[model samples]
Target: MRLALAQINPLVGDLAGNGERILAACRQAASRGADLVLTPELSLWGYPPRDLLLQPTRLTRQQEVLEAMVQELARTMPELALLVGIAEPKGGGQLPNLFNAVALVEAAGWRVVARKLLLPTYDVFDEQRYFLPGDAAAVLELERRGQRWRLGLTICEDLWVEEELQGHRLAGPDPVAALLPSRVDLLLNLSASPFGQAKVPLRHALARRAARRLNCPVVYVNQVGGNDELVFDGASFVVEACGELACQLACCTEDLKTWSPGRHPAPGPPADAVLPEPLEQLFRALVLGVRDYAGKCGFQRALLGLSGGIDSALVAVIATAALGAEQVRALLMPSPWSSSGATDDALALAGRLGLITHTLPITGLMAGFDTALTPALGQPPSGLTAENLQSRIRGTLLMAVANQQGRLLLSTGNKSELAVGYCTLYGDMNGGLAVIGDVYKTSVFTLAAWLDSPAALPCRRSLGLPERGELIGAAIRHKPPSAELRPDQRDTDSLPDYGELDPLLRALVEERRSQRELVAEGTDPELAERVSTLLRRAEFKRRQAPPVLKVSGHAFDSGWRMPIAAG
Candidate 1:
């Protein structure tokens, strides 16, 4: 039997729209003569539908759409089978009253074929809040061409059972191990897994382990696109029983492919199976995140404050690539403290990227704010207050322009600044979407350097970026990082050097390590304590920041739920 993996992008809460998307993919799969079609987890309402699952009306609408899909399939392709993810209602007076489930739709009708056993509650996933676990493993037997095939069905977290591979395991039955007794011909996992650094390899390793254990080829399909803060990288693939890759789909984009279990291996890599370099993968993920976030939110254009620093430059490059240079607008808000060379660099970078830029000097705005607030403050704002005024002025201007143009405002702050309270609350942090808030300051430098290097030409061309030399320019990439809020200002003046700070922040934020642990590992005691204090103190500021496009395993988005009143 031939199986078609539909790596699709679904809009959350749009039940009718998502149903149409599924039908469209089914048509494409039917044209390729697929015996069965598999979509990503929660393909109906999209993954992490969150509070949308709580609405009774949407649940009713889901049932209507499923029935409509059944009728449409019966009228069109009467012989093909389709597996679609959905939230199945279980009316037994349970709190959640639903199961994260898959429905097998055929010409006759549809039925709940498999329910998810594992409900992940960690990080961005809150499945336990809305779904109850299925009690048993699901096995579907189908006859095609007078031959019966047994397939084991699993949802996103069901296949994530290996503790050694996943670092930690959820408290649930082993879905892969349970399938061993069924002697199934194939194993299928539908996932809505988000993109993280090097997560693609981890997913492949997990699927390979499942394939080896089940002694059957495993097919994995993932959701692609940015849903709020989460960006799903749909690098779907088929793994042979011997832990070898059979076929792979594209990353960070919608894709569909059909594969037969016993097809002979082709020479070299499988078609579309080669993964891009790590840096390229990251860049592509960011571009997709920005594009989908803006597009899904009804914004055709994006606007950002274009400082001459690395963070804004990197955001500019990503925004240009995501929405095309014409759709991305940059406003250069130069203050009295802003250097001429920095302005020059910003203009040059904009020219190279073919971005539309308007220089909005905030020197007058700063003076007006100083005069207006002098009475309330007893004197003109000075020192940190003065510095923040410049940022707030620029932020207000960016927001006004974005509001006037109906554009999505992209925030340009980095992870290091956000972690250390180096960012102002409503000033530099103003945006609808934080493009690189999860990226460390050092990673920002690396991304900028890569964008300028000759190695990025092919990917740049693919992303609609200029193929010419030095898109970011050496002057911008090599310059010392600064906010330009004060005279000769440098990020290092207020925070530790990024080279030393990023590793510590990674340990503390991502690994959940403590100050004592860092000191035990030979870190300076004072630095460790200071960094910890700053991180905790910045909780209030991060609480109000925009939805950050999550690239790392840990981000300051929905997953990081720290209290403002925490000690």
Candidate 2:
């Protein structure tokens, strides 16, 4: 049987739109001569529909969507069998009363074929909040042209046999192991896996393990495009029974690929499984995140404060790539303490990217703020508060430009500064979206170096950025990291050097390691304790910040939920 993977990007809670999207994919798959088609988890209402499922009439609305799909199927491809992901209601119940499920739709009609077993609660997924688990493994009997194929269907987290692979397990049944008794012809895992540095490799390892366990070709289809802070990378693939990759799909975009039962992919690395270099993967993910976030939120243009620091420089590059240079404008707000070289570098980089900029010097305004506040306070604002006033001045100017022009204001703060209490609440934090908030200071430097290298010339040219030599000129990239809020101010003055700090932040934030665990790993006890305290103390600041574009496993976005009042 010809099996088609319809990797689609669906908007959350747009039931009518999502249903149309699924129907279109199914029609396209039928046109491609595929007998069967599979879609991502929760394709009807999009994954993590969140409160949309809690609507009083959501179940009734879902039925309408299913009926619409059935009508579309009957009107178009009468013989094609399409499997769609949906939120199936379990009648009336207390608390959660739904299951993440798939409906097998044919010309006759549609019915719930399978319900997801494992409801993941960790790392951006809060499935348990809405769904009740399915106890039985789902095995579908697919019939086409007198041939019968037994295919097991699993949702996003169902195929994640963590105990066998990661040595630890989440609270769930082993979906892969449960399929052993069925002796199915093939296994299908519909996923909405988010992009992360380590996620791609880990997913492949798990796919190989499942294929080995089930002793069947495992087909994985995933959702694509940016959904809020999460970007689902649709790198779908087919793994053979012996752990050999048979076919692979594209990444970070909508893709459709097919695989036969006995077919093996052309030799060399698995096309979809060939992991990109860390920086490239991160850059692509951010670009997708930015483009989709802005597009979805109804913004055609973006504006940002360009400080000539490494953080803003990197953010400018990403924004330029995501939205064209013409659509992304920069504001150079130079305070009295801002360096001349910093202004020059900002202009140079903007020129290279063909970006438009308005240089608004805040030096005059800083004097005005100090003069006006002196009488009420009985003293001129000095020290940290004075430094932050400069930032607020720039932020207000940027927000005005963004508001007047109807553009998104992109925040440039990185993980290191935001991890601590180094950032001002409404000062530098003013923006519609935080482009690189998940990226660490050290990683920012590495990404800059990579973008300037000869390897990035193709990407630079493709994005219409100047590709003659270095894209992000050496002067801007090699300079010491600074906020330019005060004279001779460096990031090292407030926090540890990035080389030492990034590892510690990674342990504390992403790994969720305690101070004791960090000290056990040769980290200085005092330094670890200080970093931990800062990370916890800064939660309030992060709560007020813009929605951070997530690239890491644990971002200070929707996923990393922490308590502000509790220890």
Q: Among all windows of ten consecutive residues in candidate 2, which has the lowest summed lDDT?
A: 268-277
What's the TM-score of each model vs. the native?
0.99, 0.97
Model 2: residues with Cα > 4 Å off, grouped in runs: 264-267, 270-275, 461-464
User: Model 2 clash pairs?
Assistant: none
State the lDDT of candidate 1 residue by residue for 1-567, as single tens digits: 889999999999999999999999999999999989999999999987999999999999999999999999999989889999999999877688999999999989999999999999988888889999999999999888778999999998999988999899999799888888899999999999999999999999999999989888999999999999999989999989888899999989999999998776765667678988889989999999999999999999999988888889999999998998889999998888899999999898899888889998888888888899999999999999999888888888889999999999999999999998999988999999999999998898888888888889889989888887888888888898888888888888988899999999999999999999999999999999999999999999999999999999899988898788866
Q: Go through the candidates in order and give each one's C-alpha lDDT.
A: 0.92, 0.85
What does candidate 2's lDDT look like per residue over 1-567, in tens digits? 898999998988888898888888877888788899899998888876899899968778889988888887888888888888888878776879888999998889899999999888887888889989998999999888688999999987887777766655677688888889999989999888888887777777898888887788888898988988888878888878887777777777777876668666566656455645667778888888999899989999999887877888888888988899889999998878889999998898888888899999888898999899999989999998898898888889988998999999999899888999788887899998888899998898889999989877766776566778776778988898888777788889988888988999998888888999888978898899888899999999999999987788789988888989886
Which residue pairs in candidate 1 collide? none
Q: Cα deviation of 78 in candidate 1 (Å)?
A: 0.9
Candidate number of the best lDDT: 1
Q: State candidate 1's TM-score.
A: 0.99
